[model samples]
Target: METVFLKKGEDRRLRIGHLWVFSNEIDTKRSPLGSFAPGQSVLVADCGGRPLGTGYVNPASLIAVRMVSRKADEVLDASLLHRRLSDALALRERMFRTPFYRLCHGEGDFLPGLVADRHGDHVVCQITTAGMDAHTDELLSVLDSLLHPSSILLDNNVASRDLEGLERFQRVASGDVPEEISVEENGMSYAVPLKNGQKTGWFYDQRVNRAALTPFVQAQQGCSVLDAFCYAGGFGALAAKNGAGKVTFMDASAHALSYAKRNAEQFGTETELLQGDALTLLADLRREGRTFDIVCLDPPAFIKRKKDAKQGLEAYQRVNEIGLDLVRPGGMLMTCSCSHHLEADALRGLVTRAAGKRRRHARLLFQGFQGPDHPIHPAMPETAYLKTFLFHLPE
Candidate 1:
């Protein structure tokens, strides 16, 4: 195997099990990166000639190397893919009673830059790395041999692909997938549009968090609920089904609000879907003097990059303040941040700052991470990103 040498003391991240090797850390003079192909597997070693691991190198990308294996004899091939995929499946089966869950969560499952979401008989896969992109055929065959879902759709429109010099496209990979499919989440049925929906048609990561709201919903019957940044009414629908007197969903996407309405209707629950920006909607609701007994603020990633951290924290604080203001005294506020860059403590601080700005005291009730299906990788902290906090506002 070809070898790529890094400068002395530059293999610290790889020694600690982090998979990525940045371009700046490599010794270009000894092992010029331009000679390596995009997805060619190469032995990674330190300057003193000690083998670190075998990883795929991408000369065109800033992430110079993505480690595939630490063992000396291991090779990146179909057999390795099959073994890793099978191991990922075994872990999920042990944790979940149902097949409807995330099958592979990129780095979390040890298969970097790959995601697979299972929807009963169908599986949606997204490949975002050149290494994984080169092995699409092998991956499809492995998925066919293992889970054997009725169909597999490749949702490869993620923006991360651009960084790896990949084109964006979505198509049926294996079998014919229907436009609409039904899956059971937390014992509730939701009909999702796979071809025309967001992130494999469902947000399975928040399944556990949505289920946690049942108790709060049941206790606050006849109470008005507001689900801001609601996607397909997951939280609002649950609240309505659990007996919220009125559920109002606010989302910027008309398409998302449409799905939310369909979900609410399918579940025989009534929800008012408002199509508008979450921040603007909150301001409008506050001006209208409309208060809710329960408010859920589940926004998308406010901080996509490290540079946006400060602005994103302020955004979180502002939206959370709006959410707290709209909540009736003694109501519940369920806030969430999907930004992996933002730590739980940072989010908690933002919530506290928002509460202080509103001159309200909030008692922490519960906090949660991503669902079990999306397991956290011990070596990579980025795998465990989602954070949800439930607070009780004083009357």
Candidate 2:
């Protein structure tokens, strides 16, 4: 019932259905941000008194308001939350044979700041924004009604929570889930560490991208593979499955290497697991005269914010150079960047620059992105973050 007014000529983007309202665009003189509490629902409008839509206000965040609905009367109540959860669940049900994919992809699923990753009967839900954080119980109620899953996890420990004026903690909302859970991805099963593993215990976004590496590995039956920053061997496991004769995985976490070893042994592949920094391992491998027919540089996002663009690009530059050095002439180079701040073409450009510096030419073969489970919002570029590219390095 409260109203938040935007500055003069600041509602054009909203008119085109864009969902975010930045703090600077608000008119403090007329409708002050201090007037509303964080995560409070408000009817957003243009300075001319024209209603734009309904959204949640977060004065503390740079993203001041996240529009949840375009209708003036719409309220993000239990009913609306139920419908959104059901709609997302229905899509996942139609997409996967088992309920193991990302059920809700934040704004991509039209529910900004909310994520739910389904692991069989156990579902892990993450709330990143103050708006969504306030509605945690309502969101959990919807999930319970829709799936009646064995357990629900509130995986809310992320840095973004701090920016949204929220506290981070992981707690069970229903039933009981374990510290470690089993997951199946692209025909490979992994015993994911739920208590400590990265991002919802799995990176389901790379599902299709890893599957795309199958034929490439199959073509080189006796070739070697180096999965750098390979957390639990998502790509390496696939390469082994596709008949890569020798596979090497490198990760900073010894715990993750243990899981990778388990997966490699299960597949009966010749595998080597190295526990150390990926960049350091790459240097040591080069020093030890190691080269692979295939190298996958699937490192974590180097760029988290816009201001870090310069530093992130430099980090990517260094990593790509190291990855290229590890790849044999005529080998395959698959590199990825999950920073939404960097576009796909820019990733290709970084790879090209790295290759050019080393006199290695890159013949780009394929471009990949997050799987269907992580849908991209056309209106929000932030939703389209994952970028993967397969290149052939010239001799």
Candidate 3:
């Protein structure tokens, strides 16, 4: 195998268990990135020619190489994929009773650039990196061999794929993909649009966070809730199931709202669907003198890239402030951010700032994170995204 050597001291992070190797870190004079194919496997080494590990190199991407194994001889083949998939499945099975969870969480599962969400008999997978994309057939085979799911859909319509110099497209790698599927979570069944839904058809990362809001909803029987950015109404369904009298579901996609409505109906809860931009709808709701006992602002990642942090923070603050204003005095607000670049403390600070702007006093109630299915690699802080903060507004 070709050996990609890093410059002096550049292997420190890798030595500490980090999995990424950037293009600039490579000792190009010895092993030019251009010499290797996008998904070519190679042995990574230090400046002194000490082998570090095995990984796939992507010359066009910022994350040039994603280490697959610490052993230099480990090949990126079906055996490796099978072992990784089996390990990931074992973890999810241990944590959850039902077969509905994230089966593989990219680097968190030691299979970087791949994410697969299991929904009962169906599995929805997304591959964002060229390295994983190259092994599509092997991944599907391993998944089928392990779980024998009814279907496996590759939802590779993510923008990050473009960065990897890969074309974005969705296809069924195995079996037949149903139009819809249900995943049980926190004693409730959520309707997921598997074929044309967002981010592998469901946000399994927020499973734990959504479940954490139950007590708050149950505290005030018949409390009104506004689930902003309610994709498929996961949060709203939970609130409705827990004796919430009224639940308002809002989202930009009509398709998402349709599913959200279906979920609310399934729960036998009264729901109002608002289809439009969240910020505009939120502002309009405030003008209409509509306030809810529980306001959930689960917006999309406002900050996707590091460069967009400033602008994204502004959007977060504005939406959070409006959400705070729409909360009834003495009610609860469940706000969340899925941006990996945004830290928990930073989110807290922004929420504090937003509260001050609205002249409201909030008592921090609960701090939430992604479900156990999405494990965090200790060396990689990037794996620890999805911050959910629940606060109580004093009367």
Highest-scoring model, lDDT: 3
Candidates' lDDT values, in order? 0.87, 0.88, 0.91
User: Could you tell me every candidate's TM-score relative to the true structure?
Assistant: 0.97, 0.97, 0.98
lDDT tens digits, residues 1-395, model 3?
A: 99999999999999989999999999999999899999999999999999999999999988999999999889788999999888888887888999888999988999999999989999889999888888999988888889999999989998999999999999988898998888788888888788888888888888888888998888888899999999999899889889899899999999999988888777678889999999999999989989999999999999999999999999998898889889999998999999999999998888798788778899998999888899999899999988999999999
Q: After superposition, how far is residue 181 of candidate 2 from its true place, in Å?
A: 1.7
Q: Which window of 10 residues has the lowest lDDT sum in candidate 3? A: 260-269
* TM-score of structure candidate 2: 0.97
> How much is the lDDT of residue 365 in candidate 2?
90
Best by TM-score: 3
Clashing pairs in 2: none
- lDDT per residue (tens digit) for residues 250-283 in model 2: 9999999888777776778899988887777788
Kindly report which residue stretches of model 1 are placed more than 4 angstroms away from their true locations once superposed: none
